[model samples]
Each structure stands twice: as structure tokens, then as C-alpha cells.
Target: MNARTGPLSDVRILDLTQALAGPFCTMLLADLGADVIKVEPPGGDMSRTMGPHPNDRAGTDYGGYFASVNRNKRSVVLDIKTDGGREAIFKLAATADAVVENAKTGVMDRAGIGYDRLRKIKPSLVYAAIRGFGDPRTGRSPYADWPAYDIVAQSMGGLVSITGPAGSDGFRAGPGVGDIYPGTLAALGVVSAIHAARRTGHGQFLDVAMYDAILTLCENIVYTYSRAGVVRGPQGNGTPVLCPFDVFRSRDGAVAIAAPGENHWAILCNAIGRPELIADDRCRNNPKRVANAEFVREAVSAWTTAHTTQEIVAAIGGRVPVGPVNTAKDIFADPHPRARGMLIEVDQPGDNPPLTIAGCPIKFTETPSGIYARAPLLGEHTEQILAEAGITDASKEKS
Candidate 1:
């Protein structure tokens, strides 16, 4: 890949985020060719000790969780508690194009590197902050000061209420959408801010709440609450709005079949050799199907179980919108996913066969994505970043 094009190729980001959301955001920017400097405390970010370790050693610092989101960025350790560390951060910020932080609302301010002060120092900077609930000005909520992880955000953000089985407790999404979604949104805001700063020489505050972002993906709940005056709960795999959208057990594994509109329902009926259902008054239209969803699911499941995942998919995939409930391995083998570069083999510095990680979901024809570097070791670029700041350890040696 003779690559020299990215959406944010020229942008430089000073990343002060930890855990999921902030790191995921910067990873996308890094994918788009930005120079992302990942900052940590003198010891390291706490997530370095997260689970799914590369080495089985009990106290190992390299977790796959950290690796997944922190790729394509350089790490530098600077303790905010110390004057020298704060000075170093200010120096780095002086020349940075954007700063992404996920500290509690006032933590950055306490450290003397809040957005207000930094923006004054460098007017065109993009200052993005991802916090638990929001800035203090946000609407009333009890957990404003309490630190939030993904599950907490999912619960309050309204995603938990409608997920999982119909009678069971609310379940969190399989992936950390609560974390990654906000980070992605914050990164977009950062880019927008960077763009505006480039034109106006003025920096604006960028704040993203995990709860708010997760709610954006749960638009259906708001509609159900408003229009139907109903509180939806764990519908399991089935959607309240569409019939036969649920996952059904198949001979091998499981398959998900959706027949949302009339045409799709008709196509699905035709594929299952049940065109009679197309004329049935109880199943003719979307509302009727939704109302009679249980009957429809059982009927579709009976047909789907007789065939393999591929066979069922072949019968009604594009025509009626159906899919097999594929596991991770299945996804890797799928033809379209491979062609789209959704799974790319990344070589761990010296590891053979390389570790395979998911590629960016977004695509661009002329400006394609390229990820050349792996996640940085702790403080991997401390000296280099300090050097770029035009100050070196030579002065500290005298002290």
C-alpha cells in the first residue's frame, strides 16, 4: 500500500484519554493519518493492567483490551501531580492541533491544563472532553460525580431497557458501544473543531457524554415511549417493530431472518415456499406481521432449521434481508467481509502470522485507510515528544 492519504493526515492529536471511549476515538483519527500522542501518568494508564493479557503472567501489563483501542498512537508518561509534568504537558499542548481527554469534569482544570486555559494559549486548538455524565451544566442526574464504566452508561442511556430476552433483565450490548460510540462521536467533534479552528483561529470546547451518545443509537425507545406510551423491555433478539427479525435455532448454529416491509415479507414467504402467508390477512402487512410476530417467527424457524446457515442465507439474504448468526470465526470466513477489509492482519512488532484485528468499518475510495504501526509501549515516545517540544532532559539533569 503506497499510501499517503488520510482524512486527517495533517492533524496532530494529544490524547489524554484512558479505557475505551477516548482511545477508540483517537484510534480512528490515527487510522485517518493523524499523529496521535497518547499521554499517560508516570506509571501508566490503569487499562494497561486490564484483562485478556498477551502473556499469561498474572500481573502482566499488556492486555488485548488496551491493544485493541490504542493502536497507531505514541505513548508518553507525565505525572500531572508534579510541576515539571504539568509544564511538559503545556509545552506539548502549545504546538498540538487537538487534545482529547476523558478525565472527570474538573480533573483537567485541577491539573492546570483545562480547555479554557489551553485554548487561550493556543486559540486554534481543538479541545475535546469525554466525561461520565457531562459538564456541570447538563440536566439533573444523580451520577454526575460518580465515575462511569460502560455498563453504567448503557443502563442510564436507555439501551439496557430494551435489550436481552423479553422477560429477563436488561442486558448490555455485546461490544462496549457505550464507550466506543461516544469516543467516535467525540472524535468527529474534535475534527469539526479542528476544521473550524483552522478557519477562524478560535478553539471551542468539545464535550461528549457516554450516556447521551448511547441514547442516540436507541432512537426506537424514544419513539416507543412517545408514540405508544409503552416502556419496552428485553425483547431478546426479536424487534418490537418487525416480525421474524429474531434469531432462530438452526441445524448447525442459528440464523437471523428479517422481513420488515411488505416486499421483504413477500420475498421471505416466497423463499420459504409459503406464499400463502402473503395473502393471509394476519400476515399481509408490516403491522399485521408485527402484531402476529410470534406466529410468524415459529413458521420461519421451522423452514430455516431444515437448511444450513448458507442454505438459508442463499434463499432469502438480499431478497428478504436475512443473515446467519455467525460467530467471530464465521465472520472471518465470510466472503464480503474479507473483500471489504473488515479484518486485517496486523503484525505485532516481531510476532509471526501477526495478530488479526478488526479493520475500520468506514471506507474511502481515493483516500484509503492504512495502519502501519502497532500500539505503543508505555512512554515509548516520551523523549521524542519532549524533543519535539524543543525541551530535553539535559535541563532536568542539571536540577
Candidate 2:
């Protein structure tokens, strides 16, 4: 852990992202051993003000939102508008394998350090972007200049059209999948672009539009409409093609049980002490069960409601696909997370206790990757990072 490690340990990245989408993407690179230097503006990433800050740890230094996505990276404050700051960024970019940013369409170009200008400094430098719509470099969007956030992306991307209960108004997802999915895709694009650059000695500009990513994530909708003339709508916890694949209420809470397959349906039927149900004409095949969805749902619900989550798991787990709808407390108490190292504990600066954030799920058998550093305080490594970039302008940093 002491030594520089990870699959991308040798790769340096100049990160100019703020808020969730950009930072989340760079964080993935940082987790995988990329030396990601987060170049923040004088005021810091906007997420610094977002909270769940500990009562005893209130400060401008950090907050929960920033900490969650900005771990394992260094921060360097820079005002892109300043002459010296732009010079410093170019110097950093000269040495970086890639540059990633989520600024509006023309913000970077207006600052004079956009991909077109940066690639001139390093011909083989990969430039990746995450935007609400998309950059004109790839394809012009009608709303390219309009500002957007997670909600905007989710709404415009067609996710909100088919998201909630089949009869009720659609709901945005609890998590920022609108941003997170695009960020995840951006990370993959960056790495792939870099791989091609290493081979061709030339880099390219790539982007992930938040709206585009969401549409891609909901791909089934497109095909359903195109192939069947059906505009898919949410069926709440179950889908139109599957019966007994909904969230069932246990005595204590809820668990999702998907037993649409023939063998699985048989196993679940026997487990519920109603083996005869499986052979019934109305439930004999997936299509029939789906057609009689209400009957299957009611029968399954009746069984699940009589049992606690644990009992339901004991009866159907491993034999069929079943999982409790866990809360944070439940996840903390669960042994699976611990065994898989899903939750990582990191040190906090003040009197607050150590904070636990999600760990990287990507596992490499030969190459090691993980969180190695806590989220940096604003401008905490300004001087150090500038020095490493061979830019002697730490004095010009305002924050």
C-alpha cells in the first residue's frame, strides 16, 4: 500500500471535473492506480458545499458528497482564466496520459485549454468529456449550451417516461444514475482511447452525453417499441414479461424474488408448499403466468407476507434469485459486504470518526487496485502537484 500501485499506476491524469459526473469518472481512474490530479477552481468543486457533514467536523475543508467521489486523488486549485493557471494546466497536460473534464460545451475552449489546444501540446494525450447533452466536437446538440444536472439528464433521456409504477407517474431513480452511468462510460472511453493512443501514437476526443448514456441504459425501451409497437411502461417491481418477479413483502420488510424460469418456478412453488400451483394451466408456462400476473403475484405475496425476510431467504435463496431490499444499516450488518470488501473505511481529519465509503468493485487477479488516499482538502496539494508538473507557479494559486 505504501508504494505507488494499481493498473494505471504509470498513467497520469489531469482531472478538471466538478460535482458528481466528472469527479465520479476520475475517481474510478484514481481507484485503479492512475495519478489523477484534480484541478479545481478557486472556489473548489461545487459539491464541497453539499453535505451530510459530521456534527463535530464542520469545515470548508470537506463534506460527505465531495468525500464520497473524490477519494484517492490529489487536488490542485487553479483559476483557468488566469494566464499562469492556464500555463500550469498545459504543463500538467503535457505530462499526462489523458485529460478529463465535464465543463459546458465551450467553457474549456473559452479558457484556452480545451482538447484542440491541449492535443497540440501532447499529440498522444487522450481527452475525455462528460456533458449533459454532448460536445459539438462529437456531434452538435440543440441544447449544447443549456446547463443541465442529474434530473435534467434523466428526464430528457427517456428514463422518466418508463420508470415508476405502470399506472402511476414515473419517478426518477433514487441514485444519480443519470450522472453515474455517463461517468462510468466516460471512464471506459478514456481508457479505451488511451489504449488506441498507445498503439497509434495519436489521441482522440471522446464524450459521453448524460442523456445518451441514460437512453443506452434503458435500451430495452427502444427495441420494444420498434419490434412490437409497444411503448414500454414501468410495471412497478415486476415486468410485463415475467410473473412472480416482483418485490414481495416479508413480515419485516421486502425482498425481490424472480422465479420466472421453469425450474425456478417449480422450486419456488414447492418451497411455498404449493407444488400443485406450478402444474396449473394458468401458471404452466412463463407466458401464461405473465398473462395471469395478478394471480401469481397474489399467491407469491401471500406466502412472502407470512414469512420474515430471513425465512423467505432460507426457503428460496440459492435455489432461486432472491435478495432482501436492504437499507444502509442492513448492508453494514451484512457479512457479504465485509467479505467482499465492498465498504472501505477512510480517515477523517477532525474529531469525527472514520468515514466509510464504497470500494471499487473491479477485481484484477494479477493487478491490484483500490482506494489508497483520502479525499484531498481544497488546494491541499496545490504546491506539491505544481512542483511535480515542473510548473513553478504555486505562488499564483489563489486558494
Candidate 3:
């Protein structure tokens, strides 16, 4: 294992999570130097089979989906339903600072390894859960028993209601923000609870609901409805409150431009060779420009459509806020990601070439965080982990 060196180096986390949301939360902790032990079932994580595998590594144990989020962790297989498995978990929990999982409400409790059971062995163990709704221990929801995924959370949480073009049903975001955001919140909760446990000699149970996370992401709509009694729908790429704050067609591609502030608006007008519009009543202030958004959009579009994205950026890049729409290819070619160490290259299983995954965004000067190791194979460290925890008979459950 790579030498752990970061803010969380001293923390030990028992990661009983699979799939994106739970894994994502633990990934953050692992990246920050936490000793995250990923406890997998007999069949391994379902995402192990969810792939975009390297063409040459068809028999690889996991694919991009699993590797991306499970990096920097050790894997140990255990059948928690068995008495030996349950004993192994209890032993691990006795030394763990936290335990994280994303199963449905009662799944862990039914298996006899839930927070209530583990807290008895280690009272200072922080137990964090991520569920579609929320755990009943915190608050019960009518849909607590219902299963949910990213799309379901987005739709029910109001995100899909305010996305995409106006006049049509909104679109789901391309990425799984529903799972990711909840996972992020759960990670935060685990860390905070661990800190409290250290000081107070007590641990607690916490949970993050995917639905609640998406609702928080779309917080603007709630205040809008409550304050103005306005049910805001999708405004497309441009918002209703800002003028000239939208993507415009450039000669080669599209570029986003925001000029809601007076100075920025003036700078934008000058860059587009339309300085006279700065003093025009219809476009002078932000509100007036928003009221005449169509005209303003057309004027900005007319100028943008004539210039290449690069040219437009060069004209007002520093003076105003602007960025060209970047695709995966563009991002790979960009220097920023490379300079900031956002793209990480890691070895793949088999004889395949190394692959690049996203790097940790969190940066600390004294103790830097990074991808020190690749994702572990299923049960890769089962023997080592079990031995370290003094678990002997649990090895019989591994298949």
C-alpha cells in the first residue's frame, strides 16, 4: 500500500458501501488519506460488472465505473449474513472510527450489523448511511422503503423541473448529482461525527437522503415560489434574472458569457463594439436588459456568431467572465486540468495500458492528498485485512 499522507491519515473508515453514491463518499475520505476498508459481499459490488473496460482487458475484475470511485481503498469480501461474517464486522468496527453504507433503510439492521448493534461494540463508532429517502432513526418518510436512483431523485427533488429548454418537460442532468451530492454530504457528516466522538467519547448515527440532496441543489426554486408565489420553470441556458448571461453561438462553437454587473456589462459592450448600448435605456441596467432579454440576446448573438470562440475569449476573457463549452476531448487537451493535476493516470489490470481517472480536487499544503494507489481487485486484501483485525474463521466465507 502507498504511504498514507494527508489530513485523514489517522482516521480509519469501514466502507460497507457499493455503487456510485456510497463509494463516492468513501472515495473522498480515502483520497484524503483515510484507511478506508471496503467490505464487499460474496458477489462483489454490482458496479464491478458495470463497465467501459479496456478492449484488451476484457477479463478484468472491474471496469471504469467501479475503478473510478473505488480507488485508494482495500477490499475485503465477507458474507455478513453468516455468524463468522458478522463477527468479523464486529471486530473491525471495534477499531473503526466510522462506518458508511448506502443500503435501503432496514437492510443493515436486518443483517444484524446496523448502527445499533455496532455501537454496542464501539460506542464511539460513527455510523453514516445514505438512503434514497432517509433512515427512520432520523425521520421517517412515506417513501423510505421505496428504492431510488439518480434519475428518480432528480425528478422528485425539483432539479428536473427547472432544467432544459422552456415549454417542454425538463431534462435530467447528464451526471448523477443525486447520488454524488448525497454521498458528499454523508462524508461530511461522518467526518464531523468522528470529530465529535473524539472529544465527547460518544458516536452517533447520521444519514443523507438522495432526494434531500437534490432538493438542496435546487434550493433557488423553493425561495422563488415562497417569496414571489411564482412557480419557476426551465429558463433554458439563460436565466430570467440576468441579461447577456447565456451561451452564444461563436463562429466555431458556443461560449458562455455573463455580464450582469454594470462594469462587466460595459466591458462586454465595448468588446462587442456596441458601446452605445451601455447608455441605452433598454439595456443600461441589469433589470432593463432582462426585461428586453430577447433584443439583448440577439445583439450579443450577432456579435458572437461573427467571431470564433477563441477570438471572443481573447477580446474580453480577463475583463469579463467567459468560457467556451468544453467536451471531454477539449478537457483532455486543455492545459488547466494538466497543470492542476486533475487528470490522474493509473495502472490497469492485465497487460492493458494505464488509464486516466479524475484526481482529488482537495489540496492541502502541509499534507497533500492524491491518488496513491489504483482500485483494488475484489477481495484483494481479504487475507491481510482479516489477519490485521484478528479475524480467522471469517476466511471460510470467502469464495
Candidate 4:
């Protein structure tokens, strides 16, 4: 019944990241039951102060942003700038399965705790890094030293170029996929490297660049530009290739309708009481329908606009792919998330009421993963973690 009993139960990771990318990667590892020891500098991760703090919990521990991404892990503060701190991290790294960081290219190297240095202590240590551009260990980029955030990656990696309304100047995505995607890829790289290390007893330096990861996420653009000589632009709610795969208006709110396949198309036509559109030459196949997108869009819009979102769902919920565009309130009220264990309620100290955070999406029947503990207060587990690492007298180290 222990929460920290999963696939990565025996693995240990030294997390030396601040802000989004690195913390997110290690957070995933922690979620999988890895002993992720978050190594924060003296002042702690910059994200600790990035607020959206609950009104009742003002000036109490870390803010929501830090809490959200850093659950199920231990925190230990160390001044990597100091000789004592450097010695402590190397000692911890020697006993760790992997080390993860997301600072700019040479930040860790400048601190004397880079991949090369850690590998010297534990030859089989998986040193994973998430960077804005990339590390030279894995093909350096010209912009390796440049600092970047979500917006920069989205714009530079071709995502923003094809986002937003079709005629608009494109917009950055609401969520920070620029950071999140790279973090996800970094987690994969770390795990993969760990897998390889377990077999070969040799670990290597691996990195996921925000720019590269986003480009990979936008694979369609790469293939289209290469094969079809088309540079895609902002597509709004629908793609140029899918005919009825667009968000449409409803009486109360919006609903997304995707009936691209012939069978689904026929079902949608029937649901909308327009079965004749199925035989219409311009709307026959996917290609023709895509060419006549405006007509298809208008037809679907006509039906959706006449009905409420609930009515639309009732008509074609299972017959074709259709869903109401949900708001925060909608998600909280919906039963699907609750039924699937997607909404996990956790207590936020100092905040009178508990807060619900999204649960782990990766489920396993035999080795399940989940949120076990809330995020730590700054260096909350410092002495305990050091004791576990056999550093009984950690008083000399900053915490």
C-alpha cells in the first residue's frame, strides 16, 4: 500500500532544475516513484516565488506554479557555487541513477557539476538535460547560449506560425507546450538512457532542445513543406486537410465536430438531418470535402448553431466524434474526469479549502503511478535526504 512503489521505485534522480522544463521532467520521474532529490540552490528554485498563490495562503511556502509541477519529490538546498555544495552534489550524484537539469548550455558546467563531471563519479549515471537550443554533447546549436521560454520555442519551432485564426498574425498557445513538450521528451530520454545503462553499465549525455522538440511536435509542417511544397499558416480551429474537423458554434457554447472518415461523415450527415449531403460530389470523399471546406463548415455550423451543445452531443456523441468545448466549470462538473480518476484532490496548506490537480495520465494495472505527496517547502527534506545519502553531518552544507 506504499505510494512510492512503482516501476521506478529503486531509481534515484538528482534534479537540478528551476522553472518549468527541468522540474517538469523530474516531476514525471517522481510521479513514477523514482526517488527524485530536487537539488535547489540557496535561494531555492526561481519558480518557488512565481505566484498565483491562493489568496488565503499568501506568503506561505511556494506558490501554485511550483506546487503543480513539483509534487512527489524531496527538496534539498545547496549552494552549488560553494565548494562544500559542489562536494555534496557529487556525492549524491555518485549514488544516483540519473541527474536532470535544464539550465542554459553551460550553466551546470560553469557550476562544475555538468554531465562530464558527474559521469566521472558514476560511470553509469544518466545525465539528462533540457535546453532551449541544445548542448554541444549532442550536436550544438548556434543559439545554444540564448535563453528561451515557451513563446520563443513556439515561434522559432514553427508552432506559432500555424496557430491562431487563419487570417490572423498567429498566436502562442495558452499552455507552455514549448517548455512542457521538451520536458516530456527529456523524461523519455532519461528513462531510455537509464534502460540502456542498466544493460550496458554505461550512461551517456542526452538532451532535449525546446526548439527541436517543438519542431518534432509539428511534424506535419515538416512533411508538408518537403513533400507538397506547402508552407502552412495559421489554421484557426480546423486543419486544411480535414474537412469537417473543426470547432463549430452551438446555442450555448462551442462544440468540436470531427467527421473526416466516410462512415463518420455519413453518420454526421444523418444526425444533422442532411443525408443528401453524403452523395453530393463536392462532399463525397475526404479530398473533395477538404477542397470544399467552406461548404462543409457552413453546413455543420448551420446544424450546430441551431442546437445547444447538449443537444449536439446527444445527437452525435457516439455516432461521430463530437464534444462540447469545455470550460473550467464544465470540467469540474463533468462526471467523466471523476469516473476516470483524472481529478485528484489534494490539501494546500494555509489555503482553507483543498485544491484539485490533474492526475497522472499514464496508468498501469501492475505498477501504477500517481501523486503521492504534496510539494516540499524549501529544503524540507534536506537532513532526511542527506541522512539517506549517508551524509550524517549535513550542517556544513547550506539548506
Candidate 5:
């Protein structure tokens, strides 16, 4: 099953990205059956060195971080700083439907292979970039030149401002949402631009800034501040507007329970043996419950703490919006992921055992998408990819 098999099988993409944001965007395309050719420098993507490596596999070229996102793509080595390398990129772009990168503002332009140059070779190419701030062509920022990572974007974009415990400095999320959200948006932008280019016979440049994407994710802050002059603070686990919409303690672990609607609230009240609270004046409705949030929380917590996480889930899992806070261990033991195909196993390089990674979530009735190949060894497909692109001579230098 080496042949591509999804809706994007007809499309080809040149991936000149590294690390999370850029690679993640291209990964989505590859999973959807786009023939993504990853153009790597001689040393390969920096993430190849990042670990959670196989415990027994020594001298492995790549680790879980690289494997997780680079699946279903071919890799080619190129030293874009050289004439031969630049020529190879041009040749590849000429046959590609799109080019995606996550370099800083002027990095690609200085190398002489930026979107401006690539678009000339393939006028219908969708050129997309992911940056810490934004590309100057779209809108220049004062901090455009400054380098940023996940934490920086999360802080500057207002996500960290309204997260974590109330009355204290905000907490960074467990995952790199700053990069992931921006990457997800870039994937959407790429698909949209490709659709437009196919229709209009002209491609355009699109960019997703990490800071901007994070801001969009925290959109509620913008409207709340603008409409009511209210600077929302850290909300902790629960929102200020909704009562009984939080993670409560259980004997074994924690479970998230939300019953903000009238009917759900009544159902929850009966389930927790607090039926009289449904008619109580201070906690009768959603608004009143919000006003007396402490009382409501104590009431829910009192019942939840006495039972196990699974017990609470069993009581109201389907009737109300409730679920336990699941860790990786719990997820591995659960049957839902297995039924949904949300976990997949693929072999690794060297003598390592097969590794499991999260699977693609998008589902299609006819054209299903999934991981079909493991991540390539550094420049694994260089000769084949170059030949496919009709490039007879190209530099394979590490620089």
C-alpha cells in the first residue's frame, strides 16, 4: 500500500519546515495523502535529535518527536545556500502544488529561495509560512525580528494570561498549544489557498503567526474586555460564567463534570442526592448558581470526593457532560481510542520496537486518511526524489 490513497492524493507539496509548527502543518497534508517531499538540510531537522528515544536503540538518527509528525513523507537533502541546492528547490517547486515553511521572516528570502522566487516557477503554487510574529509582506510587527518559541507566543498572545489558578501568575499549558494551534491553522490556510488557486489559476501567499493564532484561540478575552471593559483574570479550571463546570476530586482521581443547563442541573442534583438544591432560591438557575458558585462547587465536590472517578463517570457520563481526567496510562487502557483508531503503531529505525503515536482525527466516509509509512532516515529519499523532479545534479552538502 505504498500508493497514496486519500482526497489529497492528487496534490503534491514541498515541505521546507523543521521542528513542530511547520512540520505539523505538512504532516496533516501528508496524512491526507498529499505527496509531501520534505526538503532537509544536510544535518536534517533539529527535532531528529530531540528524544524519548527507544531505550535499547543506540545511535538512532531520530526519536519520537521527529517520528510523531514526519510520517508519510519522503525526505531529500539540499544545501539551499548553494547554487545547486537552490536550483534543486526551484525544480521541485515547479512541480509542487504548494511550499510550506516555518523559518523566521527573512531567513528564506536571504537564502534566495523564498516565496517570491518560488511563485515565479509555479504561479499556481500556494506558498504558506508559519512565523513567531508574522511575515512583513502581510503586516510587519515591531517584534518581527525577535525570535520566539512556544512559551513566548503563549505569553504574548494572552493564553497564559487567563489560564492557571486565579490571583497568581498564569501557568503554561502542558502541551505546546502555541505551536500546535498555529500549525493547525496553517494547514487550514494551505488547503483553502490550494482550493482557490485551482479555481482561479493563480496562487497567493498566506502566513500564520504563532502569537496571532494563540490570540485567536483566546478570543473570549478580546470580546469581554472590549464589550464590558473587564480584564478577565486567570480562571483556573472553571469558567466564571458557568457553575458546576469544573474538575472535582474523586477518591481515586479527578473527573470533569458540567451541568450548566436547567435540565442537566436537575438531573445532576438528583444523581448526587441533592434534589432539594434544584428548587433552592440561591441555586435554582444557571445565573443564580454562578452567583453562588462556591456553594455549588462544594456541593458537587462533596459527592464526587466520596466516589471513585469511574463511579462518578458511570453515574452521569451519558446523561450529563462528564468525564474523568485521563492520563496517557488511562488512555492506553481505554477502549474508545482502539475503536476510533486514535492510536497507531509503526516500526522504528535501528533495532527498536514499534512505537505508538496519536492518529489523525479527521474522518471521511469514502477517502480515509492515516499513517502509511514511518519517518525517513535523514535524506532517505534524496536520490529518488531528485530523480522524480528531473534534477540530474544537485548539491548534497551539509551546509
Candidate 6:
């Protein structure tokens, strides 16, 4: 059976977000059958210009960045500067379950689309605003007006300080957690508010800041600082408190191993043919491993170097929690991704190699999630969405 029945079937969302984070959130809702109408400014979203075209052919307002996160959603272009545009949005918000945007702080307020204004129009409306630091009253006063990206949040939220190694340069995590996480939180918040409205007939004013969300992504550091008065530094590979829990280069690629506790460590030691490690005093427990990490890592790396990634996984995985660090090809070829409906083939007439994105992640026994449509051509659904809002003036409208 096809995975089509979604959870948020009747919900409607006015999407004004762009780039990775905000779009990712709406994509989740859209995949789950939410009526997500992405409202772009007159020229359209900046993501359309971001590269990795469909088939290296004529650009059709498509970007790999845009395609990956935005699917099963309609598109609408509106110049909110015009009175007709503002009225169109007001009309949409009146009936919509939620409105989402990722503008710099106060931009929405200046444009007359802030939560305060929208809530007045629709009392039970949920306004989801994704900002860089936070809203004006939420401690991002200084940077509220300043522009930000994923790296900015990574640096300010303490992730850059703790990434990499002792001597390596500070770095951001591979993914844009700064934007994505906040957007995710905002989406979750919007749905929660919608649920509340369903029961109480009152919506919420929600704002998720990239800095705030990314900060939550690395919460252990905060507690560690508060309790022990010890600040964490650049740490590469394994977790600070665990042993044999890092990536190692195999003959071909790499593999990740995790020996979180003493039991797992003992099992790994046996697998590596170093049974004496269990009795070693300096390497006996977790605290000891944290103190003498370099020595233990060196010993483990040396042992792992002799085996293939798969061999190492077979030898220590499950028993000692080892796993192979796979690449894109590995993921595409893996049997599990196919079986679990995590990977799907999309028909693209304009593609040379064809477009295939990671499928919807939600899995329900009765209602499953799957891709319904590709990113729309610029303003493809402008009229369609406006019609849904019952707007008669198609030539002059904002969606």
C-alpha cells in the first residue's frame, strides 16, 4: 500500500519561511497532509537561486536546497507591500490554522504581518515566527535586527566552541542545526497551539529562535558548566565520558563505534583481543577513560586498523555497539532504507539522472507519510491557493 494518508489532513498553513530550517518544518506538515501554501515575496524565495539544478538544464525555479526540504506544498507569490497583498494575507489567515515565517526580527512587524496583528484578525490563529536569535522581548534585542545564518547560531550558541579536537580549529556541525532545529521546534509549537485551539478556541503566539533552538541541541554543556564549573572544549570523535565510541578509518571508508559504559567497553576489549584491558586500573571505568582518553583511543585505533569496516561491525556491533559510517551511495544501496519506505524514486521529466529525495520520515501503523508533489514552479499555485481562500480578485491578491 502507498504511504499517503497523513495525520494533519485538514490543517492549513500559510508558509512564509525560506531556506533550510523553516521550509523543513512546513515540509514535515505538508508530507503529513497539511495544506501548506508557501507564500513567497514578489521575486520568489532566495532558495530558488541556490544551486544543484534539476538536471543541469534550464532552471525552472528549482534548487537542490529547495527541492530537498519542500515537497507536497503549493507555492504563491505575493508582494505584501501592496494593500491588496496585505488584505489577501488577512483573508488567508482568517481561515488558516497557522502562519509560518523565517524573517529577521521585527521585519514582520514593520510589514504589518506580525503575530500581534494576525492574532487580532484571527483569534484562534497560530503565528509561527522563526528568527535568528529571538524576538524583541526574548533576549535577542541586540541581534534581532541583525541578519543571521546557520554558522552564526553555531558560533553564538556554544556549538563551535566544543566541536573539532583539542588542537583543531573550531567548527560547526555538518547540518544546519541552527536553522533546522528552531524551525522544527516552531513547527511542533504551531501544531501544539493548533491542538489547543481545537479544544479551547484560542491560538498562540509562537517564535522559535535559531540561537535558542541550537542552544537546546547542545544542552549537556550547560548542565556540565552549572554542576561541575567545568567548561567543555573542542572535542572530536567520541563523547567525552565514553571510551571506544568514535569513528575510525577502515580499509575503504570509516566506521563508528560506541562503547558507552564499562560493560560495552569490556565487550569491545574482548572483541579486539585485548582482554587485559578490563583489569587495567587506569582504564577500568568511565571516569578513568575520560581522564586517559588519548591512550585508550590510540590502542583501540591500532586494533581497528587491521579489519575492514564491515568486519569490525560484524565482530563488535550489537555486542559492543559498533557501526559503519556510510556515505550517500551506501544509504541509497542499503536494503533497510528501501524496506522502511525511507527512500523513494520520483519521476522527473526534466532530470538527467532523475530526482530522488529522502522520503517522509513519519511512520504510522494506519496513516503513513510519503512525497505527494515536487516543489512548484514559481507561483504555480498562486491562483489555486487564493481560490481556496475564497478570493475573487485573482489578478490582485496576496497568498
TM-score of each: 0.93, 0.97, 0.98, 0.97, 0.97, 0.93
**Candidate with the larger lDDT of 3 and 6:** 3
Q: After superposition, how far is residue 291 of candidate 5 from its true place, in Å?
A: 0.7
Clashing pairs in 6: none
Cα distance off (Å), candidate 1, residue 362: 1.7
| Candidate 2 lowest-lDDT run of ten | 390-399
RMSD of each: 2.5, 1.6, 1.3, 1.6, 1.5, 2.3
As a whole number from 0 to 100, the lDDT of residue 1 in candidate 1 is 20
In candidate 5, residue 347 scores what lDDT?
81
Instruction: Give the residue spans of candidate 4 off by over 4 A.
Output: 56-59, 394-399
Please write out the lDDT profile of model 4 over residues 218-269, one tens digit for every residue: 9999999999999999999999988899999999999999999999999999
lDDT, candidate 5, 1-399, per-residue tens: 267787899999999999999999999999899999999998899999898888654645888999999999999989997888998999999999999999999999999999899988889999999999999899999988988899999999999989999897898888999999999999999999999999999999999999999999999999999999999889889998998799899999999999999999999999999999999998899899999999999999999999999999999989999998999999999999988888999888778889898888987778888888889889989999988888765243323
Question: Residue 268 deviation, candidate 6, in Å?
Answer: 1.5
* Model 3 lDDT per residue over 256-330, tens place: 999999999999998889999999999999999999999999999999999999999999998999999999999
Q: How many clashing residue pairs appear in each of the predictions shown?
A: 3, 0, 0, 0, 0, 0
Residue 343, model 6, lDDT: 80
The TM-score obtained by model 2 is 0.97
Clashing pairs in 4: none
Task: For candidate 5, list the clashing residue pairs, or say none.
Answer: none
Model 2 agreement with the true structure over 183-294: per-residue lDDT tens digits: 9999999999999999999999999999999999888889999999998776688888887788989999999999989999999999998899989999999999999999
> What's model 4's overall lDDT?
0.89
